[model samples]
Target: MTSTVLTGISELWTLDPALDDPARPGDVADAQVLRYAAVVIEEGRIAWTGPAADAPAADAREDLGGRAVLPGWVDSHSHLVFDGDRAAEFEARMAGRSYSAGGIAVTTDATRAAADARLRDLVRDRIAEAVAGGTTCLETKTGYGLTVADELRAAQLLDALIAEGALDEATFLGAHLVPREFDGEDGRPGAAQYVDLVAGEMLAAVAEHVRWIDVFCEDGAFDPEQSAQVLRAGAAAGLGLRVHGHQLGRSGGVALAAALGAASVDHVNHLAAEDVEALAATAARPTAPGDRPGLLAVDAGPTVATVLPACDLSTRAPLAPARELLDAGAAVAIASNCNPGTSYTSAMSFCVTTAVLQMHLSLGEAVRAATRGGALALRRGDVGHLGVGARADLHVLDAPAAIHLAYRPGMPMTHRVWRHGQEQPLAPVPPTPTP
Candidate 1:
């Protein structure tokens, strides 16, 4: 196959533990930064990567002008399958009105009322926008469409994104919230009847088009029992599990996620000591084929604690305990959680910067969490790292070092991005909301 040699790389972070690095000794410390490096891409895969001096010549050559390259950001959690904007709710939260589950209904109503063509255009733009911001692998869910028909349509829409090579995973989040019709006599929503639908026909309808199932297991959503039922049903239907847990309060969501063996539990801002311990154990547990339903394996990976810094900031909630999870030996992942209601930004660079400056993660660790950690969270090993045989998903930075992502916050850090070896441009982005 023909190949192209990318030369003049100042720093290339492979995020692979086995790669050589001279800066730090430990596996975590050595982010596999190769200075003065060159990489060969052939047939949409990394054919060779090493120091420039020992690099084998390729059929074609391209100079990078001394840039930094890392694995493209793998955004493993988001809610990008809806219409309408939540700018008013965001403004209210900024004014100290506090975020609540009630706001999801507004988006749900708008999504259901929107024409299919309008929603598809919106999803397409949002995904292209994320890729321009250096996200190579996106995992978005269908939650706003609570009914069976709408949920299936949303799933079909996500399949279209997958065909375009923009999205890597699709999740059915029919249990994201209860519609107004399901409000209990006590006036609470998503309490009982809604959970039944999510665990039954809704789950079956969306399973064919999706690879994962998720529940909003918190106050004003499904309780522990309801959440567990949905998880077990999804697994029975042969779909992997994800959870929107612990964002609102310490409602036993973390513990439930561990017990049920979710692929990754997103929004971990309320983890207690026991929750941490349970998560560590889940991360270390081994799974083989034909295991019990709770421990069914996804790419033979552990449960991951996914933190959404942007979502926390937008909702004014506490940042997830990423440091503590890392210290406890639990795998941690950082995601954009890009949604209209909670997080409007699809900028993974912003998320990584906040992780280093505010969440107390090292630059290496933060990048790892955003890339490899995210792939592990989804239990897909082929996309996150730049190992010799891995996919050619590359993110080239305009700066010389990865630290500049955190150092120069709020700037366009990406120089060029390649997803499956297609060079993505930096313009024709999503339109800004008009005032």
Candidate 2:
């Protein structure tokens, strides 16, 4: 493999785990954030990173014109396997109607009606949009397809993308909600029967294609008990656990995620003090060694509190307590939750900006959460940081400093991108709406 030395980097936020302070592993100290840096990429991995002056010889060299470089954003929670838009529902919510989980049923109907080839094309277009905004690693879920065949097809599509190197992780979310036909009003199966179907036949079919399983643990979705049943079934199927928790109310999802050792619990807009404490406790749990190649470790660790900023804003809901989660020693990640019903954009830069500005996180904290925190959420060690021996994923910004992500929010900042040492062809990025 040809080696290249990248120079003229004004600031390089490697966020290398080796340079992290053991006393505060979550903190992004200055040591890991280098200035006037140079990096060497070889064989689709980071060979070295240091001062530009001390850079060593390489097969080729490139200058970034004093721009900032950071590890590409790792978006760990999204729903991208759907086929329709909810612009009318969003307009209704903006016009005084409250958001509810029921809107998911609308997307489910449309997704079930989409052709297999059309669904694949939709997901490809969405992934391209995410990459245009500097998202290099993404995890999307299969929840819109509520039936056994549809869910299995979504999983198969995602698995093929993984093989083609277009996607990272796939999650089975058969427990996202009970299908409308299973309302139990007539002779149809009720929510309980639907949960059984998901935990039994549906999971058995899609388990091999997905790396993790998720359940919507909230009112109007599945309760904690039903969520637990589905999650335990997923665990028995040899898949990692994730949860869609606490977006609307003080649901018991937080405690359940902590008790069950879920890898992540997303949409934590309403969290109690005890909920924060329970999630923080998971930070001290033992994690599997970080040597696995292209696979998320399915063992025990903290349940990452993944805050979806765009979803919260679009739904007119309270922003997640990201600042408090960090202060309480819990690992926190920022994801786009890109879906039709709520957040429709795949702009991870916008999510990071919201974390810094509205959520009271410092720019470093926000960037780290969107990158490394997302990696931890998925229990994957290889892609979040630009550490030595890590994947050569780079996000070169047009600005000279990283602070411009929030300093000049809503601007196009992605200058170029690289995934595994290959430069990606970027599309015209859409500007984020100013908050």
Best by lDDT: 2
Per-residue C-alpha lDDT of model 2 across residues 322-361, encoded as one tens digit per residue: 9999999999999999998889988999999998899999
Q: After superposition, how far is residue 290 of candidate 1 from its true place, in Å?
A: 12
Tell me model 1's lDDT, rounded to 2 decimals: 0.85
Query: lDDT by residue for model 1 over 1-435, one digit each (tens)?
Result: 888889999998876646634343112445467899988889888888989888898998889999999999999999998888989889988998988888889999889988888888888889888988889988999999998999999999998878777688899999888888787756655357788888998988888898899999889888888889999999999888898888988877788878877889899999888888888888766645434321235634577899999999999899898888888878889999999889999999999999999999998879989998888787776667787867789999989999999999998898999887768777866573432
RMSD of each: 3.4, 2.9
Candidate 2 residue spans exceeding 4 A from truth: 294-296, 429-435
In candidate 2, how many Å is residue 159 off?
A: 0.4
Highest-TM-score candidate? 2
lDDT of 2: 0.91
